[model samples]
Target chain A: MSEKFSLSIEDLHVSYQLSGSAGKNKIARAVDGVSLQLHPGETLALVGESGSGKTSIANAVMRLLEPTSGKILLDGVDLVPLQGSELRAMRRNFQMIFQDPFESLDPRQRVIETVMEPLEIHGIGENQEQRRDLALAALAQAGLRPAADIGDRFTHQLSGGQRQRVAIASAIILKPSLIIADEPVSMLDVSLRAGILRVMADLRDQLGVSYLFITHDLSLAWMFADRIAVIYLGRIVEEASAVDLIENPMHPYTKALVSVIPVPEAIEGASRTILSGEIPSPSSIPSGCRFHPRCPLFRELGEPEKCLNEDPLLQISAKSESHLVACFFSDPSKGDTQ
Target chain B: MSLLEIRDLHVSYPNRKGEFFAVDGVDLTIEQGEFVGLAGESGCGKTTLALSIPQLLPEHSRIAAGSISFNGVDTTALNEEGLRAIRWKEISVIFQGALNALNPVQTIGSQIQEPIRIHDESVSKKEAQDRTLELLEAVGIPSHRASDFPHQFSGGMRQRVMIAMALSCMPKLVIADEPITALDVMTQAQILDLLRSLCDKYKLSMLLISHDLSVLAQTCDRVAVMYAGKVAEQGPTSRVFGSVGAQHPYTQRLLRAYPNIRHERKFIDGIPGYPPDLSTLQVGCRFADRCDVALSRCATEVPDLIDIGGNQSVACHLVSENQVGVQ
Candidate 1:
């Protein structure tokens, strides 16, 4: 709806150089020429399985790991060229939430100190007491009740959900423009997931902050994200609105991903597609269609020549012209009813 | 007689504060070849109940009350040697993160063979090797990869090996605790299907423990919801997890906690508050504090699991009161 995007990733490539023996290749293309955009205040979900380079894309945007090539633009400004102090200065605008709160939080620090650390790092407050006040405000925004009491407790004293709320408090302390949440609820209990998600939603509504929510669960994406991008083998196989993508998945991998989601309802005879093999190691990615080996549609079509010989670039789907897909034989009407 | 029956079981572990009754009065039964699921949040004593089956609890923890009968044998009264003999032979346990429990120094084949050889010492080395390969094939792994070390296998494959080892001695009942929690969704489906097929093919009774309802809904014939060491609800999967059949407040909330791909998008809030402390276990239902529609009597007296209708059991004062109102 707006001309300027909150986060625009352009032809991003992140590859890791391999040492010693690893098949015939010496380099692993973790993320290869992927592009995406997140509008301000919109939640865009990056849906992919392990080793699909979803985290690599997040790390690259955060400059936790330098991209192999291409531009990571923040509000139309290229972040790839920014160095030391500039990158550090730019970091206050964008924050990251990790899957495990234990990994991002310090064990020795009190909850308030951890939340205040961000303000201290950015030099936002004039005094220590002022920073503590700001930290308590952020904690309250994160839905931590009795903010002062919660702030006085150490990280180890809190429950799993409380610990993650503290992590959210720290990430939101500086009122960042963009927050990249990587599998934020994957490590939490199923019941606790919705509460944390609700907290994030309330924050989004209040702060008008954009979220790049990365997760492996499609159902969560369907419930939370406005747009969903399906990634496979370091490439975007499909991208569309959440309802459109789930209702009419063009890519075979996306179809399979949707099929295997076990619904707890007593719906009889819900058929599922379990992909046969694990994702290929990044160093030895298949040419043409990277998902050919596991694509049910490709095999059902008697192994199309185009899928084996020539690569399929991300293009508009035949069914929904607006939907992007990277499969040569993605049919329009093949989405599973289950 | 059922294949496995646990009657009013209570397990306790002593701590600095007091005696922590991790598993308080739980009763469950599994018919021969029945697939049962136990689900709850962490520290809800689902794991404690599963471990008590094979007498796998640590030395300090003791079964304070109740009996666990397997194939008509009283497992609780058995000594260590007797328990060891019955463990892999009659009741094997597939632990959570059991994949990492594999010995990295040994080959996969050798690890599987260890259980087979130990159970049947009279068998020859060749016989044990043949059985190992057969078990591997049963679990969808190629026999040739038997020589591969644990490091060579993927997470799913390592889990498959654990399953294969669990079946090495032809155990009648298998207790898998959160078997697929560490796996991705696709791989988790594969493993669950494999276990389902294996259970059917061998006529083996299985007790699948997981915090997730959907995982159990797809595989288990019956599911039991636990809360703070008590069986909140237990019934057929269709009746317990269906759109409108869940009765207990805890079970109802737990059922909707997961995000279902087919279900319509709606605002779902988690059950508020934390699980009650086991060491300070008190009167009334453990879920009373978190329950939204809890009656005043719910906090004062514990309700027994009553058969409401259609073989469904619920431990809630609300359901009992409704039944009373109807009468």
Candidate 2:
């Protein structure tokens, strides 16, 4: 696997048809001109608030939603161009782990039966017992208990953490190369979130799994992800290595986000850069830079003219090769900001 | 006197197989002008304790033991009318999920006025309207939006309305039971900041209950970690967060779950087992089955809440008896 990138999203654009008053036709661009690449065995966390187009990007990549425009290249092959049975077959290379584990798994089906469905659909495994054994193996890899205990249990019988492990078992049973986790641990308690992350990390190491981790938690993204991509309204504001982004974020939106995260040490009445505005509706995004409405620079400098007139593209500076940001007044390494 | 005190509180529900105790023997106290957070996983009797405070327990359930005192008065002994007198006027509650808690048919203004109307019928409609406007402004919501229904408001704004309703009667203590659970992280911060400022402005005591420790650590003065309907540990937020001698592995595992932004590329270490079922009677420590350092005595004898220095307390065997001597 000497590939340059495991999953490449190139100029991806996703739109939804909106109905106006009196049934008028309108189009809403949910994800616009977003491009990024995830390395093999590395995690690229797509972070944003609700309606920030993070989930839309995830859906577009998983082919759960049709991409109106743009290309999704997997292992040098374009997934967008493929259609019908060919696209369905191509989907086998990527698997999705949903946010709600209890809702994702079938309620009536037993654990073995649920995990076996994927194997059976993929037309792998020889017999029932073999599928059972494979399910047990996947469960064990996810740090589940003995094969006998989990085989006959229903989804409701298990706790949130255990059900998530079961979901992980189901996703990895097919042994896909890419895993799309959309807020996988958001519903669970804090004590169980780390355990799930560890399981995902172990799977990535052992089986070489690339991930598109979507979440609203910046702290988790800073810690777990190899690279962090900040999405706002429908565009990528910034993309950089996790450490670079956390320690020295260039984009104003990213900086505001990082500052608001309440860490234990940072709780001593630290004067944080608090952005004072609400998340705008996706249908009616602000002109120019999507974040211009809430950007402190727009307010403090009283120079909303340029920020409200020109759209910014993610551009690289003289810092790191991988680090990129989309802002009018950003300097990558130094605070020699424009 | 403490604004609120709970001594040996126990809540149980009747089932086909006798009775099931959701909240076992537990004790807690909230001082005046202090913000105490009650944190635990789901089914940890956090909500049960909250419901028990207002004498709002379900018909099938009752306070099997203990007493709840508010403003030096025994709340458990209060009758329906007696509880009503103190409900919003003395101690108010803000339930989780603003959409469900708010009446969709009523305007936000009327919803807020309901508390005032029920508490003091002598106040005229004009006074109620004036009070509603003031409450809305205090919560950062515009007075004009009071005419809007619950559905018209955003999740965060609706939560503000809920807070406005909770503060309508000028209660000394406000019990927010997972008020921001359904909101986004940014909205969550905004609401928390509002609550912090309001608590300061009014000098109001609060009982903030949630399952997320990180969420509570931001605004809480003190925190009590609950497990199996019992307080596993309680102390100042900083000391409890930074380092505490907790003998229970459950508490230790919870501290490890927070993601450290400074330490990138490191994986989180989550706890292994699930919480125990509340219905089952345990002879020893309730967390004994899942505890990593469980001793033989853990299976047969329950650990009492013992002091562990610096105003902290833990109910575990790992901390030396000298360090966590029984109170």
Winner by lDDT: 1
- Among the numbered candidates, top TM-score falls to 1
Chain A TM-score (model 1): 0.95
Error of 2 at B99 (Å): 3.0
> Tens digits of per-residue lDDT for model 1 on B1-327?
999999999999999986888999999999999999999989899999999999999889999999999999989999989998999999999998888999999999999999888887988899999999999999999999999999998999999999999999999999999999888878998999999999999999999999988888888999999999999999998887675478998887886787666767765668777788878848898889888999999899999999888778999999988988988
Model 2: per-residue Cα lDDT over B1-327, one tens digit each? 888999999999998788888888888989989988888888788888888998877789989999999999999888888998998898888987655778889899999998898889898989999999999999998899889989877888888998999999999999999988887778888888888888989999989998877777778988888898888888888777666533456767675677756444466776656777766666888888877778898899888887777877888876645453544
Candidate 1 overall lDDT versus native: 0.90
State in Å the error of residue A241, model 1. Answer: 1.1
Q: What is model 1's native contact fraction?
A: 0.67
Residue B217 of candidate 2: its Cα lDDT? 75
Off by over 4 Å in 2: A1-3, A20-26, A126-133, A332-338, B242-249, B262-265, B320-327
Off by over 4 Å in 1: A23-25, A333-338, B325-327
